[model samples]
Target: MHINALKSLVMDAVDELKGQDVVTLDVSRLTSVTDLMLVVSGTSSRHVAALADNVVEKAKQQGIKPLGVEGRTGSEWVLVDLGDLVVHLMQVETRQTYDLERLWSDFPSDIHEVRHGEQA
Candidate 1:
């Protein structure tokens, strides 16, 4: 699937799991690592893991498998590498500590304050 469509699917999956602070960063100009970075926050470790799992499953349904997934065991921060779209599912604390948004501040971002029960 196209990168933008993949991104939307991933975000929808996370939204289904009640993910918050959903942010998408366009990293096309910054580096060749990936085209987009999706960062989302979960309430707890289990929540984060669930969010990540949902995203992975949804992506797989669309015939897209992540290149790799990291930090699932701990669930403090889970990273799903989707070649051109890397997804980050993290607990609020870890997210704050890492401050990935700030680290990649140069990239244009679309921040969505996800509200529960709302359609993504």
Candidate 2:
């Protein structure tokens, strides 16, 4: 699929697992590593793992392959790397500690917040 469509598909996959506090950041200008960074919170490690797994599965079902997946061992923070999109699934505590949103917050215009099945 096209990049935008792929991005929406990935976001949709994240939503499927009911991930909380979902946010999509357009980091394409800051880094070529990925075009979009999707951050989400899960209630627990198990939920984090499930969310990551489900996203990978769902993406693959649509013929989209991720470059890599990391942090499955701890599940405290799981990352799914698609070429143009990187997904971060974290527990609330871990997410707070890392403060990715804050670290990347400089690019406010790049952010698109989605939570509770609605956009902010």
Candidate 3:
């Protein structure tokens, strides 16, 4: 699927589960591993795991198999890799600790907060 479509699929999945503090970072130039990074915060570990599962389920329904899934055992921070886009599902504290947004702050990229399922 196209990057934009994939991105929307992720956003919708996250929104379906009411993920908080949704953020999207364009990292195509910063890294070749993935074009976009979506950071979503969940209330707890279970919430994080559910968010990741929803993303994976939605992707599969669309015939886009995920390359890999990580952090399922811990459920603190689960990452769903969909080739062009990587979805990061984390608890509030975990997200604050790693701070992916600030980690990539120095780079010239399009970073925006998503509110109410609307792209900023």
RMSD of 1: 3.8
What would the per-residue lDDT of candidate 1 be over residues 8-119, giving only the tens digit for each residue? 7987898788899887777677778988888899999999999999998998898887899999999999999999999989899999999987788744554332333445
Best by lDDT: 3
Candidate 3 structure quality by residue, lDDT tens digits, 53-95: 9999999999999999999998999999999999999999999
Off by over 4 Å in 3: 108-120
TM-scores, all candidates, are 0.86, 0.87, 0.90
Give the whole-model CA lDDT for all candidates, comma-separated. 0.84, 0.85, 0.89
Query: What residue pairs are clashing in model 1?
Result: none
- State which candidate, 1 or 2, has the greater lDDT: 2
Better of 1 and 3 by lDDT: 3
Best candidate (score: TM-score): 3
Better of 1 and 3 by TM-score: 3
**Runs in model 1 lying further than 4 Å from the true structure:** 106-120
TM-score of 3: 0.90
Clashes of each: 0, 0, 0
